[model samples]
Target: MMMQISIDPASNKHSLLNVMHRFIAAANNMDETIMVPSLLRDVPLEEQANNNNNNDDDDDVAETQVASNKQRDMYEHYLLLKSIKNDMEWGLLKREMSSGASFLEIAVKQEEEEQQQPSVKRDLAVEDNADLEHQFHYHLRGLFGVLSKLTLQADHLTNRYKREIGGGNFMR
Candidate 1:
């Protein structure tokens, strides 16, 4: 004998919480699948190269070099995904700011930029509570899309890792 659990599809299907849980599960699966993180160290990400190639704004040699150096290997991506999952579960903690700029300075610069913008644009920023709810939903939908992509990426990485170790038959 077996017991079955019922769930309401309408309530859970497109919910932000559900999307987050999916990402967390994928991240956990990735963490378990990759036993040796160092194996991924020098492996270049295809998506990163594609993204860099798509951007046409890299006109300067220094900027191009910087962008190339900014590219992370699979190991870094694994750590990043795990870190993001941890942050999503436990909430983000503030870290020490870099020496480049202080928070107050950044805030002042933003205020100046906002002031320089047109009055009409600033007026449009003001909204009622209903608009706030709409904005929240809109951002939530975008977040869901991003998280879903990340979940798929995690699964892809796991499969890639397994293949790298000559266990190509194993996949999730």
Candidate 2:
């Protein structure tokens, strides 16, 4: 069976939205550059500090800090994309899409950054042991979540999109 749809080629709003979706797609896939970095951009250091700072035990605090820091970075990109609206949003989006990284490289970078902290090194050693399983589950959950959201959006579009007669145009 043949299925057809129409889109107005000159809609700037749609173009802008497409750009937004591109970044979102990258983030949804957990790409380190456009997605992960943006995820980290807005996490106030104060909150990060406080999350682990509450622990009285220094070792516990160190472990908590390392764990939470990694968590914060994981979805940093999506959070960033969610924060973007009008105004300078395009600039941010442009920069992110132009430069992003894979999960492996991001991990390497994080390792390099934490190399100086011996306590974090211990924590990282612990983390590395289960890295594959953690990544697998995280990506699995992310996959479902992104698909659910995208499916909902597609459903909404299907509901709104009306077919036009005698032409390849669709009315929304």
Among these predicted structures, which one has the highest TM-score? 1
Candidate RMSDs in Å, in order, are 11.4, 19.8
* Tens digits of per-residue lDDT for model 2, 33-128: 232243234333222344344434543432433353344432342343344422134555455444686556666877888876979788877888
TM-score of each: 0.58, 0.28
* Candidate 2 ranges beyond 4 A from true positions: 1-112, 161-172
Off by over 4 Å in 1: 1-11, 47-70, 94-130, 167-172
lDDT of 2: 0.42
Instruction: Return the clash pairs for model 1, or none.
Output: none
